[model samples]
Target: MGGATTEPADEKPAVYYANCAEAKRAGAAPLHRGEPGYRKALDRDGDGVACET
Candidate 1:
């Protein structure tokens, strides 16, 4: 029998954005530090928010 796999709530998914523009276009801007698709590169000021204008 195969077991089901689950991801941690605090873990980010495979989603990724090369830049803020992409995130904004995708309507996923202003990503929190622990949110899915949120990356350190996106957080320019090292703040919790990402893609902030």
Candidate 2:
């Protein structure tokens, strides 16, 4: 028998944005450090500002 697979309750699905414009369009802009959608790529300068327009 195969057991059912499940995700942790605290785990959130990743939201990918092609660029800052896309993220802003979705109202997910100004993402700070350690935020769910925040990534080093988004924060190019690594100043903890993600999706800054």
Pairs with steric clashes in candidate 1: none
Model 1 bad stretches (over 4 Å): 1-13
lDDT of 1 by residue, 1-53 (tens): 67988899898658888899999999998899888889888888987898988
Provide the clash count, candidate 2: 0
- Tens digits of per-residue lDDT, candidate 2, 1-53, equal 67989999999888788888888988999889887678888997889999776
Candidate 2 has a TM-score of 0.69
Q: Give candidate 1's whole-model lDDT.
A: 0.87
RMSD of each: 4.2, 2.0
Positional deviation of residue 29's Cα in model 1 after best superposition, in angstroms: 0.6
lDDT at position 43, candidate 1: 84
Give the Cα lDDT of each candidate: 0.87, 0.85
